[model samples]
Target: MNPNKPSKYLTLVTEESRVEGKKNTERNPKNLRKHLSSIRLSRKLQSGIDTDFYEKITKKFLDDFYPKKCNNPSCEERILDKEISTRPDIIRCSKCHRQQSRLSYTPLMGLKLPLYMFGVVFHESFLQFPKVITATEISKRLGIEYKSALKLKRRFQLFCSDHLPKYKVLTYRALEEEYKGFKLNPDTETDVAPKMGLKPYVSADACVLYSASQRANKGRSRYRYGGLTSSIFLSPKLGGKQVGTLVHGICIQNGPAFFESVSDTKANTIGPLLVEQIPYSVPLFTDSGYPWLYNIYKNHRSVNHSAKSSEARYKLARNRFCKLSVHNQVIEGSFRLLKSSFSSYCYIKPEYSKLYLDEFSFIKTSKFFGLDCITERCFGSQFSWEGRSTGAREATVVRIGQEKYPHRRSSKETKKWLIQAIKDRKYQEPEREERLRRNKEQNKYDLNSAEAISRSRKALAGEMKRFNDFWSDSQKSKHKRKREIKYENLSFKIWNSIQYYKESSEENPTVQFIADKFKLDKRTLMIILRKWLKYGLIQKRKLFNKESHDKRVDFSIVLKSDSLPHLLYTQLPKNKKIFRRMDQ
Candidate 1:
């Protein structure tokens, strides 16, 4: 129905019903496309218009408004005439139905140009604009006038495409009609996500969008900006495609969220973050870019592709590798398609590069999959920071694997350790213990009265030195001060509390995390750990016992009876000789 047409219920009647509402309204049914047709006709009627120009404009108009089905109001036909009905807004047979594509009502609706022109522009941008050929060259290839090409470029710039997120979670009820052979009915039940009440370990990776690095203005070219799109994919065990959610995703500059763009996304990030927000422990999977991302989770696992492989390449590529290795296929495929299909998009203006990439990310996700999947896949769909708020918790259904998980140990063991530490009274350091002790010894320094406690710069420096000294040996103190509280205790505490921040997982601690977590001399601690590992402890499996090999070294033999028995002596090395024994 035309919104512009007179309303049957309202009083303001403009065009006076060509035929009364109940009286032969079918004679001239409402055709909203008449406006677009009028626009086309007006363009055709204009003087000085060339035949090529008319055909081009006419084609564009038709393509833009074409329908896949008969949109005519009077046509009550059930069976569709695909060929005739699929025509553009132009009439077919006596029916004269308006045509529409599935995308006509979407963000693509406002576009005024044809799809061929748009598709061509889209493909060209992926190759990176301002490279092999100029926009003029593109105009020649598309057979569009230079002005028309420029107009199409502007429209593409303004036209919004859809973006689909690589990661998506779907419940049994919600995941209907998505896959080819899969069915989500009552009888077709499968083990869903967060299996064993554990949190789902999702791996997130990002691909850089090269096409978004276009120069804004006409004259100069700058390609400083690009889009970093991140995806979080669920593992196969948890119902694979059947049960999953694209929990988070975002497009941003190259930063921590991207893990420096080495290769794969870190599942550690996805696991811990998901666990915190949702309920349960999540064993995450990821690439070597974030070797420790899995450790951040309360319960997690990982496979580093950067390591060497001893097996055959073909065998490794097959079922075993797929099952063992957590590959981000969806994210990887998205990158491949973006690069192949839209290479020309790279020629966007530098200023709009960021904006275009951001929108482009959304467009791609939405186009392939619907908005629902996109929402579940991209974390930053509604929020930012790669879809996670700085302080937001993960879902409970996820669990982050830890080196020394607290749940793995008995409660009695944990309690015993804490009690022993308290009994030893070795918790935090005493700040003013020395001053108080000295005051107690002197009668002139009244406990109630405030003495002249002005600190000298030199004294302050000395105090600082002592503090540094104490901090330097904190690891030792942490170990020896209480036999019950040793390295395992330390590892346990760290494993439990570190969460998904960069600190808890990396082999080397970030300065900030170290400085804040334990007031220790980080430099000294690092040095000590490194030196001890190299020099102190031998490999546990090595077998070498000097004492065991020479058991007779500790025993002295004194012959009692025979003279020959008394003639025993040790053999010396090289020129050194034993005492010459002669029997009488």
Candidate 2:
């Protein structure tokens, strides 16, 4: 090699490593050591990781986890300052002249790594990139040890399970007015499923839950399997790779939906999801396996479960969905898509089953929801699954403390850590207010303290109102003077986008996809697209007459009675989806 030429492994080695040269020895292996020491990987990672961003996030997480005033009743400190120590981030109590380990009181405590590196690990784990990543692969890319990467990976999995959101009920009234019209009750008894209630263009189903780790254990019983009942929706109006399904509530791509570990196909396990999630007004094109026409949902028994007719009696109660055009194709496709979404190791252990489910949920929804949103949602959570007084952190911290005690080289590290961490935690023990907040989060929007839910809904409603107001205002003028131009413009934008999606290998981009792309209202955009693409909406002008007003007619109302399905799907006041009265 030339004297001035850089080494081929220069990218992999750090400045210090280069200076040390081969004579100093590479950090390849030290099999005799019980645990491998962190090498130049930390420095390399630090250089790559955005320290400032991670620091801010760490501070935010710490503030949310730990309390102010040293958490010590006797301490006079009002505010804590974050400083770097052996633990990376510790809150120093000015008055007590003591410090509290930031991550020590949370799930992220222990498993030595810098806060910035931890942040990087978290940031990368939640990311939907390369579509195939393992701890080994991550270790190589992040320049960290495989074990550390694996630990981080496991922590993320646990984190996902622990902090999975208790989603707000997607009520009928809460749905956008546009989608509300399409949401139909599938109950055949109450005349709910109209002759023409069709919303989903196509749908798929996936109902199996298995893991590699779980299967590897021979003693693992078949009964231990988790039942993942999922539905994937392809929006009718949106063409070209536009699909949304119920994950939690709305399908924001890799969205987390109603998930449970139950095996039996009973109403109790599936009712809440069907009623709250499924577009009840919209015809669900499910397969023959789930021909559940009507289910007397828990907390929603107003619709007489006495059976609509012989057909209704034969269907829902019997689990007989025979002889239907709809198949489990969409969900089946989704399931296949899901399995392939992961790399080689597709199995998960039974212990972290729910967490694994939650992970898949977010992964699937990531396409629509965006990785940033998923990451924020995953991290901001308090990991409430364990049901502790202060939510997940309390239990997680305790577990971590116990786990780390054995990992320490001697009593010195453990004792020093315990003094600061345990003392701070004990001082800041959850009070009545903290407990109440936990309860609120755990139970979600209950009857008595519906305030939180109401507030959230109000916030969402305000956002929707603002969005609608802006579009509505624009339409108010365009509805009359430039309706045709509006139609043409929207048509061009929608169809052009569809073509673009197809050209980009998204063969069937949904109208929702287009609408989402343009930030236009789905209802409004779909309506225009229908007129232009399907209903022959054209603005005819007199030959060479610049001043002549084009002759065009609004064809939106014509479809209101065109067909039974059209009538059912129409926007008429009478056709509007009716919501069940609020529970007393």
- List model 1 lDDT by residue over 11-54, tens digit each: 33224442243244345456535544544554333422233333
Pick the TM-score winner.
2
- Residue 52, candidate 2: alpha-carbon lDDT: 53
What would the C-alpha RMSD of candidate 1 be, to one decimal place?
Answer: 26.2
Query: Candidate 2 lDDT, tens digit per residue, 312-350?
Result: 435443323322232334454555555565435555433
User: What is the TM-score (0 to 1) of candidate 2?
Assistant: 0.41
lDDT of each: 0.32, 0.39
lDDT of 2: 0.39
TM-score of 1: 0.28
